[model samples]
Target: MTIAIRMPPDVQSVQIGEQAVVFIDDFLTEPTEMVEAACQSQFSPCPGYEQGKGYPGLRATAPSEYSLRLVELLEPLIKINFQVPEQLDLNKSACEFSLTTVAPDRLGVMQRTPHFDSSSPYHMAVLLYLCGPEHGGTGFYRHKATGFQRITSENLQTYSDVYSDELHRAPPKPRYFDDSDDHFQFLGMMPARFNRLVVYPGSLLHSACINPGIGVCADPRRGRLTVNTFFDS
Candidate 1:
């Protein structure tokens, strides 16, 4: 089978505080067939996400040839936006097809609130939207008390302490965080679009704006399917 690949030209990027969310349109060329096949196959429950009823989805270290090709296309953008080192450590990266397994009402504390992918500023996250807008988008937020949108290694402890206290003070309501409350200020939002890829710092406080009305399906073809990846340079 032949895969069609198109290189994006001068992608647009939006800056949110210390982080940038680069948007790449037409990220993949005809990826539906491959994605559907993967979704229909067996997928193990993702650890640490089960409590929230979040779909575990599948992960693969050995990516397909098409995925490797896409990486090559993304490298230039990463180097420019993230200022990544010349030598990228692919060994630490994997491709994940995330599915929303949990319902909004069933979300746990951590799942209900926004979270950072990592405390390290050097780490980056790339989320490729494979589904439509109904799957929901992503939102960035700032801790009201700390005025911090991105937690770094230096402030991780402090942020954690403050966050824990805030949680204790007012437990999160059973639902996905949609807007700023007394504790967090909503910074920005990135709408999910088919074949759209968003690249941002892993340290940014963000959350998936899940549409609770839509039953979180295990099928990648119909669910909130996304290719979530992390990179360390």
Candidate 2:
């Protein structure tokens, strides 16, 4: 179900399951500009993923400038009475934010992998697309029994079995195979538009869908440029 809340004249909020994703028309003007600056600044390689490296990125260059604006705009939605406890703290809440530029090759393997978020109930994630919808969109899913929806690559990294290429690599997990009849129920897909931000429980199961019939290097330009953060309540 889609529920809408007006933050004011131009900004709006939408809640899907336990996740609250807020959208601000021109709210990201400054933050977007900051991100562009970071992309060119002395960037850092992303922590775990070898395939990804953030140019100086926002996390270091001008983090306070980049995050304060986002925190301010999202404060209203964060203060709402959500079911998850980790997403409720207003005064003590903290988040890890970064700028990401996904190369085309990495996006291919990601599409076929289904993963879970390992964060406990106290953590949620927000992803802001700095690019356009044509790049790639965020996919959300509802896990059985768990009821949690809207997953991302960050969530899958929690399970060692999923990340270790050698363990579950060659044959693939039985559950992920077609014959297993295992499939995630689609919760929703976040639009990949500039300034479009998607926030959801970090523990949800989600993944990025690969562009069909496209080679990794065919159009390296087709990948996504996103700024993401993980919040703890």
Candidate 3:
């Protein structure tokens, strides 16, 4: 079966504010075959997190073909200074890709687990999704002074420029509201759209959610395919 993948028009930039999350729509190049091949290739499976921690993410060493394509795609964003690179050496290998698959309709598993990438150091965290509204959506949240609430997926979703509702409200009390002194509040929710890409600061706190309507059959038959890339700052 041939899956239809559509790439949006070239994006300028995807930035919101100090909230810590940003997005870049249509962030891939033509020749998506390389990326597809790399994503389908075997790599180490992330075991996932425990009962009281964050979500688990798998990492893959992106193939050169895929990496080169990514660099070309990102050059525009970099040239306009829409995105700042953490490295001065353009010749250095500064990109790595990973794929995170979220099964459909598994809300219970997703909502409960919130997380941030713990990998050593990556300038930006790129989340390029290959699923449409019929499946999962990417939600953005932020770390509040107290607890974390849901935020809007504005710059990420490509639907609207609206932001999260919770951020504007006054900080709530009750002191012991959440697990940590700081919690990630929701910013925007990206309704699953094929070939949509969300790029944000690697230090930001974020998480993923299942579609809640569809169901998966088994491994490799995922409802959403989230391709991740960590680039040198």
Report the number of the highest-TM-score candidate: 1
Could you tell me the TM-score of candidate 3?
A: 0.56
Runs in model 1 lying further than 4 Å from the true structure: 1-4, 8-10, 53-63, 87-92
Runs off by more than 4 Å, candidate 2: 1-21, 50-62, 81-112, 143-182, 210-223
Query: What is the alpha-carbon lDDT of model 1 when measured against the actual structure?
Result: 0.75
TM accuracy, model 1: 0.89
Kindly list the per-residue Cα lDDT of model 3 for residues 7-84, writing each as its tens digit: 544453433334434455554454255346545766554445233123333445555555566665554444244345
RMSDs, each prediction? Answer: 2.4, 7.8, 9.7
Worst 10 residues of 2 by lDDT: 173-182
Q: For model 1, how does the per-residue alpha-carbon lDDT over 16-68 read when each residue is reduced to its tens digit?
A: 76678998878667767557656565666677665653333334332366567
- Model 2's C-alpha root-mean-square deviation from the true structure amounts to 7.8
Question: lDDT (CA) for every model shown?
Answer: 0.75, 0.48, 0.45
Steric clash pairs (candidate 2): 42-56, 43-55, 43-56, 86-122, 116-155, 117-155, 151-205, 151-206
Candidate 3, RMSD to the unseen true structure: 9.7
TM-score of each: 0.89, 0.60, 0.56
User: Candidate 2 lDDT (Cα, whole model)?
Assistant: 0.48
